[model samples]
Target: KATMGVIERNGTYEQLGSITTPTLIVVGDEDAATPYSKSERMHFAIKSSKFAVIKRAGHTATVEEPEQVNTVISKFLECCV
Candidate 1:
């Protein structure tokens, strides 16, 4: 659950706020590992970004609610394009 290594190696967090790409930040309401607030911060930092919260799920929302996750991802992709 620790992304610090990846972030440091890739320098992902260094320029996070500068990224202008269409970003979809998805988080689970019950995600204790990463937490929803961390996802919210990313969404806020990115200029062109969308955020989604899946209920009744933990860190793995895509697995917990496939249909809901797909719908949200589809809608976000559509909107971005």
Candidate 2:
């Protein structure tokens, strides 16, 4: 399910950035694919966006550091609310 969901191309990055909706980007310091730099670029491109980095994790930081990732998500969601 996750693979299918991830594979589906909802839209191009530019289109996603063009959206007025707020965006939150979280990346691990060691991510290889969709690296932190890419997330940084995404955040910069989106007018209203926030970005965070997990200190010691890779691509699947949410799984590698659930508590830290949750913390970032919680904080970001709070800002949205």
Candidate 3:
């Protein structure tokens, strides 16, 4: 099921703008699972989106830099409210 979803993910870039809510997109500077470039593209597509890059981290950025990820998330939530 997960593989199928990955192979055929729903939604399109044209629909991204429909998301009016403020969005926080965090990705590692060296994320291999999903490259940071993809996240940057998403930030560009979403008008209300903010992007953050976790330096010296990879796909598991949250695990590799829990404190940094938490801090970023906290700041995003604070600004969102």
Q: What C-alpha RMSD separates each model from the true structure? A: 3.1, 3.1, 1.5
lDDT of 1 at 59: 89
Model 3 clash tally?
0
Give every collision pair in model 3. Answer: none
* lDDT, candidate 1, at 64: 99
Candidate 2 lDDT over residue span 1-81, tens digit each: 988887995857767657778788899999998897788988888888889999899999988999999999999989898
Ranking by TM-score: 3, 1, 2
Query: Which residue pairs overlap in candidate 1's backbone?
Result: none
Prediction 2 TM-score vs. true: 0.80
lDDT of 3 by residue, 1-81 (tens): 999898899768788878999999899998998798888888999997999999888989999998889999999999998
**Candidate 2's C-alpha lDDT?**
0.87
What's the TM-score of every candidate structure? 0.82, 0.80, 0.86
Cand. 3 Cα-lDDT: 0.89
Clash list (residue pairs), candidate 2: none
Which candidate leads in TM-score? 3
If ranked by lDDT, best first, what sequence of candidates would result?
3, 2, 1
Q: Give the per-residue Cα lDDT of candidate 3 at 55.
A: 89
